[model samples]
Target: MQANYVFRVTVQLDPPTAHLDPDRFETVCRLPAATPGTDGWLFFQYNLWRGDIADADHMQSLLMEKLGVEVIEASFSELETDSAYRAALESEIETDLSRFNADSVDAVVHQHLGSSIHVRDAEAIPDA
Candidate 1:
């Protein structure tokens, strides 16, 4: 029922802020899998290209908002989804093949996610 985008962030602390606990962090943010062909469904399809963030500045802004901190560096990790959720997503995609302009669900998934999608058990997801 859920999919999350994983990211790693590093926040550099200036000398005056050196006493802060940590500078690097890893976190997951839930991004619900909207039905296929919707605006929400374009998030991954548009924002990421070739397994990388399409716009560093845009991603930086997103990280700042999600983490509520000044991020020195940030990188996308993966789209983690459970098997049940992935199956459901594929089923939904099957219903809207024309919107994706793909012949099959697998083609649409590959077009959008590239090679960054990871199917895992829900219990394995760490608390964000």
Candidate 2:
């Protein structure tokens, strides 16, 4: 349940005079984990081109709506998950290997996530 896809976002003020410190700022967006074996799980493959955001206008619209600010840029960072989540995801993958067109769980994970999956110990995650 703690799994998520993290994005690094840059935002700008509508008016340059809005903030004296900086007109542009950096922020992070933690998208909830999409259930494995669902189309939502293909977010990286369908929504992103390369490691960057594929559709700038769409991303900007989404961020603007959520953050209530002008989104300057957004980039896919990584899929952060606990070991338990990873195990579950792998189990889900195993249930339908044909769906991924891959022989093994590792292949399916690599095909979708590439090197952007970060597995961490569940206990290491701090309470929010």
Candidate 3:
């Protein structure tokens, strides 16, 4: 049995950035629980991305240091299966067309750092 966990995080960027290089814009970080000898608590994940690499790094560091997000990780694979990732990308196009001209900052954040964890065989249980 396998379980998939997808985390959606919202971040606000000071200077708006374009999504030209979506691959370079996104990253993911994982923070394990702090309880002693605890098998399961919770894994906190964050996605950070923008137009510039420097901005992405700054956000990553902030989340790790100030936001109490530890065990930081970075990767592009997270977006492959994330539903929010797809939605966010689509939202960008919608925003671009809408008259309100609303900026999709939330989608931008997820586009950069969103992640998904698949727990292998974690859902299997023996019959009692």
Candidate 4:
């Protein structure tokens, strides 16, 4: 039997700068997990920035509350069905990294399934 889950993560940038610094922004760390009676698992993607100056915890809390998403600390197992989804996520990370310059800025990518996942995090799929 397969299981599926969705991850909702909130990223907080430091200094609230005007431009994003790609070098300072490290790779996104994710904790994948599965839901009951599903075929795939959800993951958390986190981007770490240099120079601590913002409250990531506070920002995460606000985002989860505002978006009415369940936020928890857990691990997710990879699923074969998520191959395409992972590819799209990697592509977006590449794009964001490419756009990074020597500027202090912040951005967020909310990931989920279907409309729940932001386009920035998920790829565009046609109606099934």
Q: Pick by lDDT: which candidate is best?
A: 2
What's model 2's lDDT at 3?
77
Clash count for candidate 4 is 12
- The candidates, ranked best first by lDDT, are 2, 1, 3, 4
Clash count, candidate 3 = 6
The regions of model 4 sitting more than 4 angstroms off are: 1-56, 63-81, 100-128
lDDT of 3 by residue, 1-128 (tens): 11222223333333347543322233343333223112431122233233222344544565557444342333223322233423433454454533323356444334443333222232331111
Instruction: List candidate 3 segments past 4 Å from native.
Output: 1-57, 66-80, 83-85, 97-128
Q: What lDDT is obtained when candidate 4 is compared to the true structure?
A: 0.33
**Candidate 2 local Cα displacement, residue 27, angstroms:** 2.1
Residue-pair clashes per candidate: 0, 0, 6, 12
Residues 1-128, candidate 1, lDDT per residue (tens digit)? 55676766666544564565565554444445554445576677667765677788888887778656776676767778888777877887898789778899888777767788898888875545
Off-target runs (Cα >4 Å) in candidate 2 are 15-21, 35-42, 48-56, 126-128
Q: State candidate 4's TM-score.
A: 0.25
| Model 3 steric clash pairs | 26-112, 27-112, 27-113, 47-113, 47-114, 48-113
RMSD of each: 3.5, 3.2, 15.7, 16.9
RMSD of 2: 3.2
TM-score, model 2 to reference: 0.72
